[model samples]
Each structure stands twice: as C-alpha cells, then as structure tokens.
Target: MHKKFMYICFMSNSKLYKGSLTTIILKLLNENDKMYGYEITQKVKALTKGQLKITEGALYPALHKLEAEGLLSVEVKKVDNRLRKYYKITENGEKETTNKLDELAEYIKTMQALVNPKLA
Candidate 1:
C-alpha cells in the first residue's frame, strides 16, 4: 500500500534531519515571528507532508539550548487557561539561520555530487 511505502521511506529518512534539527528550527523561526513548541512540530509535519516528526523530547532540549545560546528568546503567556511558551528568533538567530542555510545548501550540493555523480 502507498501508506506503508511512505511509512518505510519516512522511517529511513528521519535520521537525515538529526544534524540539521537546529538549523530547521532556526529557519522556521526566521520565517515566522514566533512559535510555540507544539506549533513548530505541526508546522514541520505539515510542511513535510507527515514525513518528518519532531518529538517533544528532542524539540524541548533544542529550544532550551538555542535559548541558552542567545539565539532565541522565549515568552510565556496564558492561552485557553493554560500557560504556553513561545519562542522567537533573536537578531543573532536570524544571522545564524542564514549561515546555516548556506552551509546546508553547500552540503546538499556535495551530497548530490557524491550520490549521483553522473548528474553532477
């Protein structure tokens, strides 16, 4: 079935994003002004068409690390009687996003050359 194929493909591809997770978060935050943890997860899922899922265990630590690194800032507010934390990219984060994106682009090119040398 198509669903089973997609599931298998997604499972294999999931590990590809591990090194780029922070860059992914930074790029997403750069595109959007601010996002809560769950919002970021949903956005990634929607954008990837369910191929990639960001787990809470992985997501929270990255957010915390970015915050500590001075690249992202957080705000807390109450919504629907529940407190929610929102993350916003700092000015430095925008710069880092650009840098990471450039690096990723180059990495992709290198991978392409190696993976499909005829195309390269």
Candidate 2:
C-alpha cells in the first residue's frame, strides 16, 4: 500500500509540476545567479532525484515568456565554439521569485489540508 501510494503521488506530480514551471525556473535562477536552458533542465532532474524532467518544449517557452515579461535577462556567450544563452533573474525577477515561492507554499499547505486533512 505504501509503495502504491508513492507511485500514485509521483504520477500526479508530473501534471501538477507543469503549472509551477515558471516558479521553478525563477527559483533556480535566483539561487544559481545564471543558468543556460540545458543546465536548468539537468538541475531540476538532479534536485528531484530523477523524478522530474523538464523538456525543451516546455522550458524554452517559459524562458521566453519570462524574458518577455522582463523578469529575466539573458546573455549569450560562446562556449566550446557554440553560442549559449544564460538566463539570470532580474531585480524584478528576484522580487517575483519571492512572491511566487510564497504563493506556492500556501498552495501546498492548502493542498495538504485538502488531500490529508489529518496532516493539516
């Protein structure tokens, strides 16, 4: 029963995680100073212990949207004869990161209450 519950939670996580992608990216940039697209993907996987994977299809669009919103600034540099774009959280982004993280925390608390009221 415990293993089955764990499996179910992990499966649900994939769909739930998509909604928090923007916040996840912002939080990572806030901590790392700057990161490239692929680096961000790898970091999420590592941090989640291989449970979570961020695909390029989802990541690039979120990065573009955040850049467009002025929450992120990008710098392109040549590395190993290839151009790589690094994303850094802007001043606005730093502020937004705090807001988003707080919001996510509250959401998690609410979810806990709903899913397992005894835990709350």
Candidate 3:
C-alpha cells in the first residue's frame, strides 16, 4: 500500500518536472563537472527518490537547445568503443542557472502565498 501511494505521488511529480526540466538539468550539471544524457536522467530520479524521471526524448532536445544558445558545451569521448557525449555548463550557463533558479524560487513563493494564504 505504501509503495502504491509512492507510485501515485511520483506520477504527479513527473508532470510538474516537465515544465522545469531545463532548469533542473542546468542545476544538476552545475553541481557536477560533466554528465552524459543517461547519467543526468538517472541522477534526477535518484535524487528525487524516483519521483522525477527525465525522458530521453525530452532531455536530448533541451541539451541541444542550450548548446545552441551557448549555455552549454558538449564533449565527445569514446568509452567501450562507443562515443558518448557529455555536457558541461558554460560560464553563461552558470549565470543563467542562477537567474533561472531565482525565477523559480520567486514563483514558488508566490504559489505558497496563493495556495495557503493563511500561512502567508
């Protein structure tokens, strides 16, 4: 029963993270030196206790967009005879991560005030 409840909660969290996916990715990469696509997805799920999973379809596109915007730089390295692309945050990406985090924080504060006004 507890596992079932956790599964339901995880589904809801997945929906919420979709909109904030890029911000989450930027923050994660900021903390780590570099990460591959699959590594990023696994880290997010692990950190969120399986509540959040970044789909590959969603992740690759966001990485490409950030790279195009100069917010990220990618390096390709061969491991086990296969090439893997690792992403690292750029100087601009660090600055953008700060701004994005501040924006999200403000939004959360506004949401708290509105969702539970008595606590505000």
True-structure lDDT of candidate 1: 0.88
Lowest-sum lDDT 10-residue window in model 3: 5-14
Reference-based lDDT, residue 14, model 1: 46
Off by over 4 Å in 1: 1-13
Please list the C-alpha lDDT of all candidates, in the order they appear.
0.88, 0.88, 0.84
Off by over 4 Å in 3: 1-14
Clash count of each predicted structure: 0, 0, 0
- In candidate 2, list every pair of residues with a backbone clash: none
TM-scores, each model vs. reference: 0.87, 0.86, 0.86
* Model 2 global lDDT (CA atoms, 0 to 1): 0.88
Clashing pairs in 1: none
Root-mean-square deviation of candidate 2: 7.7
Show where candidate 2 strays beyond 4 Å.
1-13
